[model samples]
Target: MKKTIPFSLLALLLYLAAACSTPKQRVPEQTASYTPASQELYDTIARMDSVMFDAFNKQDPDKLKEVFSEDLEFYHDKGGVTDYAQTMENFRTLFERNRDTGLRRDLVKGSLEVYPIVGFGAVEICLHRFCHQENGQDDCGTFKNIMLWQQKDGKWKVTRVISYDH
Candidate 1:
């Protein structure tokens, strides 16, 4: 009597065939690294960053708003992405909530690195830490941020933000 192939064996063979039939390889492309920003530029950015964060820590929306571009795009790992208006709304909510507890953001010392983007503007890579006090309890954590700063209307404005690595 002739015997038929087992169902399990046939399924395994089919799966193996499907998986092995495709030869897939991911080739990564490289681009030139950004040029380092000049000291003067770095100093200017640092000062601007200081002002920006000071407003955040103090929950001052006006000061915080001035530092950002009207076409700002903010990306957060936990909260997703938003445009300038949404970001402002978020800031308003956050400021209202954390105003009493005194939320603060501090850049890790020597952790900020700046790069020039040839023509448009510059990029800032930095590690920042946040701390806040609430309900007689203290909480804190550190995260990474990549900010795209552009010059517009004769002043520097942050156009984009990538906040991640919590």
Candidate 2:
């Protein structure tokens, strides 16, 4: 007596056999990414940026401290990756050096741009000009930076800085 095999079962077996016999092709890794803009988020980051940079130039460590996450990864193009302590130390040195100089970093007019990183947080791209009024000399220069602000536990803190373009 001959046994009958169901059509669905036979088709599935044939498909599996064919699939198993074929060589698998490698899939290329995705290299494209997109981030959208958030105005409310921009307002928040703008406020945060003001809090951090203004206080920074004023040498207000307490106020400056409030804006950055403890695990900050500040990467200055020239200074390399600096952690919290190193950044504070650099700030201290900078503050000490420019105590009476009126050293300030001002965002270039209309250069501020913000992009949301979905759940991570946001990214700010801007050009800034650093000016110093020391003695009888007032000097200034422009630069650009990309900053990453992260959100954790409902609070947003600056986590990274790709500072460059002096």
Candidate 3:
């Protein structure tokens, strides 16, 4: 008598076959025509970027604090990692140092990208430049910045930041 394959064995084989299938790798498009998943989200984050940096340019530490979460994590290429308190203190010091000439932050035109994070608020990627008057001339540095925004109680704040490539 010929024996037939058991149902359990067939099910296991099917499961194994499905498990062995490769998953498609997801990568963000790097083209000039890249678009955000949500235009409203893009606009909101863009506005937040402008407002946050405006406070920074104006040397308003308190205003900046409003935009940064209490659990903020700042990662800088040269200065290393910093917590919320430390980052705030650093900004205060920077403002004091540049009190005369003053520092300004400008977002590179068409460099901003916003991506939704499901349950979280969003992620913002962009290039920005910080400029200051130095020796009767404008001194500037451009850098790549990534920010994770968290929305709670109808308010949004930056939870994490990666500032690099200075």
Query: How close is each model in CA RMSD to the real structure?
Result: 10.2, 17.7, 14.4
Superior by TM-score: candidate 2 or candidate 3: 3
The digit string of per-residue lDDT tens for model 3 on 1-166 reads 9999999999999999988985543222346877889999999999999999999989999999999999999999999999999999999999999998868998888789999999999999998878899999878777889999999999999999999886
Question: What is the C-alpha local distance difference test score of each model?
Answer: 0.83, 0.80, 0.91
Task: Give per-residue CA lDDT, model 1, range 131-157, as digits (tens).
Answer: 899679777777888999997667989
Q: What is the C-alpha local distance difference test score of candidate 1? A: 0.83
Candidate 2 regions exceeding 4 Å error are: 1-36
* Model 2's TM-score against the true structure: 0.74
Q: Distance from true position, residue 96, model 3, in Å? A: 0.2
Deviation of model 1 at 50, angstroms: 0.4
Sort order, lDDT high to low: 3, 1, 2
TM-score of every model versus the real structure: 0.76, 0.74, 0.80
The model with the greater lDDT, 1 or 3, is 3
